[model samples]
Target: MRFLIDFFPIALFVLAYKMADIYTATAVLMAATIVQTGLIYARDRKLQTLHKVTLLLVLVFGALTLFLQDERFIKWKPTVLYASMAIALAAALWIWKKNFLQILLGSQLNLPAPVWARLTIAWIAYFLFMAGINAYVAAYYSTEDWVNFKLWGYVFPVVFIVGQGLYIARFIKDDDDAVEKKP
Candidate 1:
């Protein structure tokens, strides 16, 4: 349910691209993203920083794609987004001496500071890799190929997320274990 909602825009864009054209797909993506964000805000009563950044980039890049009649702008959006995330994570970890991943998930999982730092660095590296891959695909491939990559390339994130979950499972304290350890 939540997964479908989160991917509504991308799915719509893919469908539109297959049925119509890149311009049409861009328009669909723009509208779908706007609606998706609106629905999220309506349900949550607030928007996260990630949601805000995604929405802003979609609007800006979508507009540029439409105005310029070039698909490159929309194609570059993912690379820009990924690069920004990588930079933000790196800055948070080094300059601010903060692990943003820990800040976001610390309440749910209690991990040591070193573990959190490693997780943060892992995410930074992942983001950088994803950004490079996206840029390479967009620059070297055709529009159709890029669209196909966008749809199929989701496998990378799915694998990364699953691997992260498995890696962190060892650190997560089960309820029974936590209770037994409590004095």
Candidate 2:
């Protein structure tokens, strides 16, 4: 359910590209992203920073793609987004001595300060890697190849998320620990 809502735009974009062309796909992506963001806001009553960023980039890049009749803008959107995320996370962690990820998710998950710092660093690295990969593919590959990579490149995030969960699992206190501590 949640996954479908999150994936709605990308899925639609790929489908549109297959059925038509990059311009049509860009339009579909723009419309689908708007719809996806609306649904998220309706459910959560507010948008996450990520959701807002994604929406802005999609609209801006999609508009440029359509207006210029050039696909490079849409193709480079992911690289820009990922690189920006890496910079933001790194700045928050080192320059400001603040961990945005911990600030964002600390309430839901309790972990040591060190764990939070490490997680933040890991996220920064992941974002950089994603940015680099997207840039490489977009610059070096044909549009069709780049589009195929976009569809298949989803594996990276899925694996990274699962790996992150595994890394944090040991630090998270289970309900059983609380029950035992009560005695």
Reference-based TM-score, model 2: 0.98
Over the stretch 50-157, how does candidate 1's per-residue lDDT look in tens digits?
A: 899999999999999999999999999999999999999999999988889989889889998988998888898999999999999999999999999999998998
Where in model 2 is the C-alpha error above 4 Å? Answer: none
Cα lDDT, all candidates: 0.93, 0.95
Candidate 1 vs. true structure, TM-score: 0.96
Task: Report residue 87 deviation for candidate 2 (angstroms).
Answer: 0.4
C-alpha lDDT (0 to 100) for residue 94 of candidate 2: 97
TM-score per prediction, in order, is 0.96, 0.98
Q: Write the per-residue lDDT of candidate 2 for residues 30-123, one digit (tens) a residue.
A: 9999999999999999999999999999999999999999999999999999999999999989999999999999999999999999999999
**Distance from true position, residue 87, model 1, in Å?**
0.2
